[model samples]
Target: MSTEPRSTSEPRIAIVGAGPAGLMCARVLHNHRIPATVYDADTSLTSRDAGGSLDLHADTGQIALADAGLLDVFAALARYEDQAKRRVDQHGTELAAFVPDADDDAAPEIDRGQLRRLLAGSVPAGTVHFGHRVTGVEAVGDRYRLRFANGGHADADLVVGADGTWSRVRPLVSDAAPAYTGVSFVEVRFDDVETRHPDVAALVGTGHLFANDGAGLAIVAQRNSGGQIRCYLSMRIEADWPRRAGIEPDDEAAVRRYLLDAYRGWDARFRPLLTDTDSGYLHRPIHALPAGLTWPHRSGITLVGDAAHVMPPLGGWGANLALLDAAELATAIATQPPGTALTGYEQRMWARSGPLAAAANEGLARFAGAADHIPDHRAEHQRYQADAAAYRAARA
Candidate 1:
């Protein structure tokens, strides 16, 4: 297995996972007239739920979209007004609020599904091969071979792992794995909010409503498109609490009882968020790789997005970082020599994501009550907004 840089004239590139990172990479590579194939395990594009909303920051996410020629399309679909944020205590009393100016588009919100669709549609139709579940990756001479669960295989000169936290391709480069962060969220939703659930709609407001007791309990709700409200009852609990407590994930009543007991002394206004829902409950245990993690560069393979650095959703930086990573990686691949491009991309990614990953871990601990003091999230948002503004100005 030679580790030399392969010819750039027609390097065979394979991107694992069709999430934002992989799709963005393919789109950018296509823009440069470089061809890459993306493999995803899902049967189709809409096979699974696309998750919640995301606020793409100007310096990171927006820049990536602009590079891919999707910024104008993104701006048109983004919810600029929904950038407003509200924080409240357990009693539903307002603690702080930050309403963005009418013209403020520093960080605009877009549905996760919407963003995925935009990126997916940007690439060529046949660029993505669905239903290909990668079972393992092996070095074949100077190239790499990907074995799919469907008894199929494909060989590539270079492999990019955008497969996410539990990426199969990650082990080929690093030994680090995602560990539970001692926090879990039971997600619920309310559909037709303005008509069917006006009270819930008002409670959540135009953007996001965070009701934290500062003692490890919170009801965080965000307004999605189509007048729907998605709520996450977050808590610091045992990783296997559901199974140990004999609470089946689908047992909505049991989960509701557990949440009600956990939040026993909270105000009654927050109950509706837990009880009324138009979707099944999703138990999500937060997990993250070690902060500031780095691995020695290996030729013929590298990573992007969550596959490289996954952290808590503290500042909504996960997807933004992933997008930026894809754009940078694609740019490097298109310009630099094969081996040098992977090495340089890894160095740049490490330097950029290390501090943000550390901060996200700390913010998770504070938000989950591992620390003594309650976090001032509103203040944090203001600082982030100001920093983004400064970044754009400096670049301009």
Candidate 2:
């Protein structure tokens, strides 16, 4: 549940879910000399960072990082010159590739692990309490009392729900929940992609290589910071495909065999990605907040990241929006009273995140299975590229 407004000498804030959103919220708040405690259900911060590479855009993600003073740290870990793009047919025939102009100031790619570690390390060591899964929320005077699964409790003037899509804290503010977008991803990875898996690596190219027919089948490979290749297989299948197929992600051989059987007629190089796998297979079904999910201001409570507005990862706005939310919320609170800042932040976050969320969902809907919708994908992608460049230029 959400928190009730409380009046404290220090404006105690409780941030849930310690991901990019929660950590950034806490980091920004700490920068402004506000006291906040971060809570996460994970046993530790290093639980699991198994997402693919992410390119921090110039507008949202980069700006937010700069505000948090972690731009340099992000750059130090960024994989510049890894922004190649391409589209191919199901048979692996290259269709189009936009030669990218490389610049050190360009969008720098970082492994999801690096981004999380950097953000987690920046927050004060003792500020975060791990293994504290929130069970419920109760209003106490102007503040809220947090109940933990371990019989522990804490009170705060404000509670920020940075927990992801299935946020336990979200139910308190609004009954809105995330719904599936009829898409699911089978995550695949290759070890030492270059030497060990030359053909597959070559098929992947430098950065992103997508093959699709626009209906349901797609193979997208993204190069990670290390010598690993992160691949995503998109399919329009029954929701119970995993159970029906009896697919055991832990069984690498079975997973590889399944891939071979599924995409049998596709290019041989593309087949080995699933064939020669080093890591376990994983599934992620995209879910998003409805078109315009907003709620009335609930004093002492707000949301950031997926908890606030979950959307598909087409534009990679998940972490970026959370970072921006952190910077904006902290700034608002520092410059005004609790009532004003909390209310103002919610209004702005809802208005600001709606369109980005829509755009992300749109990308997943069209581009997920329709990578080869050539004329359309190319025209749309270029327009976005130009828009991104323009945004960066204008900011500069």
Candidate 3:
């Protein structure tokens, strides 16, 4: 319920969507002496759920969190020793890999639940209006009004659509919708990795692993926190393929069988990944917004995060970029007046995020075909690239 009188002139801001982008944006604005109300469809912080884990990249995601003064809190939740990595083929052939022992700490990762808690807690007690799924945003007599499905409405001076991929507020700026990327993941999980699924544990080391034989795709194992490994039975199919397969998201058995069929030819080393799954099987179709998707700036409204530009998860840029969006938008608002700050924010956001979106699409192409086409690339690889450059510079 903390409200800072908005410069005694500017109107209140409404940030739609309570995900990373929305929450980070709110936090930055709150820190900058701007009052913003965050809205989400979920009834409470625990209303739905937070997923597995994420590595906060130092450049983007971690930097943004640091800017918001949440880095130490995040570090408290990060699984530092879980940075081990391994990649294997179906025959249990150890591919390129690295897994931190009890001592090594590479790219530490944080559990989604902990990160979500940090974001939700950082905001003022009542700044977030949960269960308020925004339906539409329109200009109402010089003010912006948000119409929710629950028949409630709120007005603000500026409305930001951090609502994510199927953003309701997207139409306010552009008519673009995310296009099918022709990739689907049958997501399965096995909890208590060390104690429960020994075979899968043998197959998967730590950190992450990729097993693709250029036949079918099976990304199996290794997650930070909770001692669980998430396996993805990736398939390239038409947009309607999941429904055609009769896959029920809630029915783990049905989806498991479907994945077993899809990845049938792979090495038996893959069995423990699905055979020991404790969490139910699920189907998730990957989709992406067209790269370079920028719209004309309309006053009193803007888009942020996945609502602004959604791309494949391959780039590891989705959450990190979203968090960065919040940081930049907050910068714009905090450093300048609403009228000027918004314009600067949109311009930089579009410039920065648009290319990353395109890069994501290019990366998605590798995962789109029946056989994986793109070469393997991980965050460590990027780090190595930077390290090599530094080494060369130092040697010279």
Best by lDDT: 1
What lDDT tens digits, residue by residue, belong to model 1 across residues 1-396? 221234557878999999999999999999999999999999999998888889898768988899899999999899988888888888988877778877777778999989999999999989899999999999989889889998888888889999998999999999999999999988888889999998898888988897888889887799788777899889999989999899986788898788788988889888888788889789989999998889988898999989899999888889999999999899999998886998898998998899999999888877777334445544655666677677668747
Positional deviation of 97 in candidate 1, in angstroms?
0.2
Q: Mind giving the per-residue lDDT tens digits that candidate 3 earns over 62-145?
A: 768878999888878888655555555666676665544454333468877777789989988888988898888888798778
Q: lDDT for each of the candidates? A: 0.87, 0.78, 0.75
- Give lDDT tens digits, candidate 2, residues 1-396: 332334446668899888888888788877887767898888887876537898776667777787788898988898876766788888877788854555534455788888888988988878788889988777888777889997878888788888899987788789998998888878878878778988887788787887886667787789997798888888776656777889764666676676677777787667676666676778777778885578878888888888989998776678777888888888888888877987888887787789888888777777656563443433444554576577558746
What is candidate 3's TM-score against the reference?
0.88
TM-score of each: 0.93, 0.90, 0.88
The top-ranked prediction according to TM-score is 1
> Worst ten-residue run, lDDT, model 3?
368-377
Name the runs in model 2 displaced over 4 angstroms.
Answer: 1-8, 104-106, 248-251, 372-396
- Which residue pairs overlap in candidate 1's backbone? none
lDDT of 1 at 348: 83
Q: In every candidate, how many clashes are there?
A: 0, 6, 5
Question: Of 1 and 3, which scores higher on TM-score?
Answer: 1
- Model 3 lDDT on a 0 to 1 scale: 0.75
In model 1, which range of ten residues has the least summed lDDT?
1-10
Q: Which rank order by TM-score, best down to worst?
A: 1, 2, 3
